[model samples]
Target: MQITDFSVDQNLKELTEHRTVVLPVACYVTTISENINGYIPLHWHDELQFIHVVKGTANFQINEEPVAIREGEGLFINSGCLHMAKDENSTGCVYICLNVSPNFVVSHELFTTFVSPYIQATNLQYLHLVPKDAWASNILESIRTIEQYIHQSQPFYEIEVSIELTSIWKNLVKNGIQLEFKERETLKNQRMKRMLNWIHQHYAEKILLEDIALAGQLSRSECCRYFKRYLNKSPLNYVTDYRIQKSQILLQQPQYSVTDVAYQVGFNSTSYFIEKFRKAMNMTPFEYKKYRN
Candidate 1:
């Protein structure tokens, strides 16, 4: 089943539980599309997540960095990371998201030794798995094999899945993704989370740099630097892009005029809104609405 809603307080979501008595596995595979809520909201979970782009492109916001995982590519999200995924280009995308329980690998020392550093370290928030890269190719193959085994459920399927997952970890270690932890990373993550939530809450209003800085308990200059470092964009730039994204949803409704949708999403000028929308989407609002319909 696809998860459509997430709790905003802790932003912690629980994965689907399998009905296994002896060898319990908390892994789940699901496809996301417009049929099942167009996008996955920003949320975090204690378990690690693997996203395989099977059919189309997936735009992932891991922490605050925007990443695009195209078809045949994949990404690994560390445990307890703030993340969300949506269809890129609004073409509609389908992908497999697997959430694995950390407990499942606790008994395996090999897996823990190779993977724990990347998983547990707050700095190593996520890893993008590209099929063209040697090590990442191996890891993606392992994930595909595991997905097949879980669905096929052949004899000794559990054993097969476990072995494949181990292979993935081995390749991950070889790729040098494992790194030492920084003690300050945890605090940085908390501050980012607070600022992100505040942006999401008030993006439709007229917000200032001072308001955003205060949300993270930082100075205005620090707030600008923080977003630039992590998201590679200024705070206002992110807000503008977010407004454009939100406008896409509103535009799908035939009754809403382009001007009305623009203002509703916090854009003061309709012409300016159209310009930004065109730059980001490469199409005018009317053209986009017709295409989407």
Candidate 2:
């Protein structure tokens, strides 16, 4: 019943279209949470990121990191890596999340459709995530530089962050790899496309206010406000409707029971699940299953 309104597809499409010169994230925002059990769910992006956990404990992993990050830490994941954040069910956390694109550094490196291996005769197109030094002062300074860069759209903003990021790379990414992001000149788009992509990723999980806040990283409330402004419903309802569509394929499977299938598609309560299904499909899961057969 947490349905509101937002168009996830439209939002991203707009972002993709803005091929800016100094490509930093819209802004630098921090999320501080006390619940150690809070999970960001699994996700990935084309942009490289720097995360500084200011306080408490956090269990974070970049692809192939081989171990979860312990408390009192930070991480710098390379571009286009599968990453997620969670708590150890022990302590709260305050972390800073920063994102930068390859174009933000090297604009000449246009994102190519074909992968290039062996740049210097070795099989390599991108780099891997790795570890760096943990000098508290350097981390603090680097974080500040990024914040400053975001505020002033001045000349050489990209250059400033690039230098600091290099320092951050040497200081934070633990046993990591480095790969540059691919850039394309003709990829500008409308906002709807981005929204579609965002919604596509987390539709199966238990999406929440923060979940859809990711629609554009607009604060959870703003995400709802903007979503209501455009798409006319909330992000939760957006996911539920999408889940119902995806469930149609599963409902036909004889292996599923209505209740079991509802949860599988992301409904926690069978009753609420049934209500949504009926609201969207004009029938409960039972009827849907019967019809499918």
Candidate 3:
């Protein structure tokens, strides 16, 4: 599906229009809606983003690193990072997103004068993910500076804001750790890879455990044992979960009826799809569509 038609992209555009992309200069506020679960469906951007969880809590999967951001905390997402955000059941979330275009930042005088001193020794390409311990104080301090600029907005407060933003990236790369995807369990090493690969390739197709076991080169019983140990769910359950995720996009789309969506996501029976969707999403297909609207 074209991502431009997707809700996340629309939300990002909305934020951009509102001047939340960056602080007080080229930045725009994409959104500040309440009662929203932070689970923004996946999207990408050329500009880098620093996502602050100002209120409530959020769980995110940043390319397989399962990290949680709490109130007053935030994440330093790299440029072009494929990330997903979901705030769990609780009060609504409000995030202050600071978007920075790397191209503009690097070419601008601000980067060459003040920022060049930091990246001089480093060869960092990806956006740095700032873990809590890695310059946590600096991260919090920068958020404060941004908040001050946002609230005060005095003459050229933007320049002060820019300095804080630069400090975040510079200190992050200087002190932040490069995080890779969490390693698969040692016990199910090979089998897990096969199953994950299969799921990724065929999430939209009807999947079965026997097929998964065969692909993983394990007997059904062994597959059941090792798969759950590593992935924390049964093979069939995992596939159902993936299908429900596909159903979410269809639900969000103005086109596609519930039945069409069900079948499109690989379910054969509408009743079964409704039941599964309700069980997974806590809302039936029809209700989900209405909610999206």
Candidate 4:
């Protein structure tokens, strides 16, 4: 609930710490807003995820391509896919993100027959469900229904939630397109995940492109190209942006001065940090802290 710094390993697998948030049920639902940081940084988990854009628009970068879901639209991200979410145009958006562990959904032996092929289809990173389409609208409604039941928490809500999920899986298997896995895609994802994990680990230190490349075992040029191809940002630029975002949590506290927060998040130059902070947040650190309070 505190929206703590992301907990991930060298492989970029988020430790979701589901034990605390998801103790009673295998499913977890929450809403995300740009105010939290404007983006959910690249991370992956073993559970399946569904996102419904309730207001404004959300841009989800899955694998590498960006898919924009407008209000009333929904998206499904398969398990183990590298992805990130942000508000489109920073207009502020509200989206429900739900993660359901595999164990919760595949209770019976026959369920595997329905879901295994798609999960194994490495090329299918996500599915965008638009309300205008017929089958997609049906899936969208099912997601909404599940959300409603979870929020209401009436008696037998769990049973109702499972029924809706079953319908969603059945429809997805019937209508979803299968992606063709290229020879290099698997290796590419692995390399990207490793690089991302390394960034998350050492962001508070002075990290260079060479250091990030080492995590992925690539040369400097190769690393830049890889990030450009997948994340569309240079390694150093990404590191700076990440450091600025991480500084927000510190800024929210009263004890850490602006300069201290900047240095704590790996920014060596306070002036440079303020410039980037203003560029990303449209306010000075002092202004943001005062406004937040």
Among the numbered candidates, top lDDT falls to 4
Quick one: how many clashes does candidate 2 have?
43
Q: Least lDDT summed over 10 consecutive residues: which range in candidate 3?
A: 1-10
Those runs of model 3 whose alpha carbons end farther than 4 Å from true positions after fitting are 1-38, 42-47, 80-82, 89-91, 104-135, 147-161, 174-239, 252-256, 290-293
Which 10-residue window of candidate 1 scores lowest in summed lDDT? 5-14
What residue pairs clash in candidate 4, if any at all? Answer: none
Off by over 4 Å in 2: 1-22, 32-37, 64-66, 70-72, 106-140, 148-159, 166-293
TM-score each candidate. 0.66, 0.43, 0.58, 0.87
Q: Give residue 52's error in model 3 in angstroms.
A: 2.4
Candidates 2 and 4, the one with greater lDDT: 4
Candidate 3 lDDT, 1-293, residue by residue in tens: 01122332321222332243344333322222232322564444545667666677666654335577777777765554445566666546666666666544443666665444433222232333344565756866776577667676688886777677667766775574443343343224445556656765776677888888887888999888765654456888867876787677778888889999988888889999999988877889999899897
Residue 131 lDDT in candidate 4: 85
Give the least accurate 10-residue stretch of model 2, judged by summed lDDT: 1-10
Candidate 1 Cα errors over 4 Å, as ranges: 1-46, 51-75, 82-98, 106-118, 127-138, 150-159, 166-179
List per-prediction Cα lDDT, in the order shown.
0.74, 0.53, 0.60, 0.77
Give the per-residue lDDT digits (tens) of candidate 4, residues 170-277: 777767575576758778888888898899889999898899999999999999998997789999998888788778888989999999999999999889999999
Q: Candidate 4, overall lDDT?
A: 0.77
Judge candidate 1 at residue 22 and give its lDDT: 38
1-293 per-residue lDDT for model 2 (tens digits): 10011122312221232123435553344443322113443345556566666666566644323234433355655544444466656466566667665445333452231112112111122232222443544765687677677566678786776677656544433323353333321121112234546677766676776755665646777666654544456867767767876677678899988877888888888898889888876678788788769
RMSD of each: 5.7, 15.2, 7.6, 2.9
lDDT of 1 by residue, 209-278 (tens): 8888998999989899888876678989978887887788889899999999999999999999999999
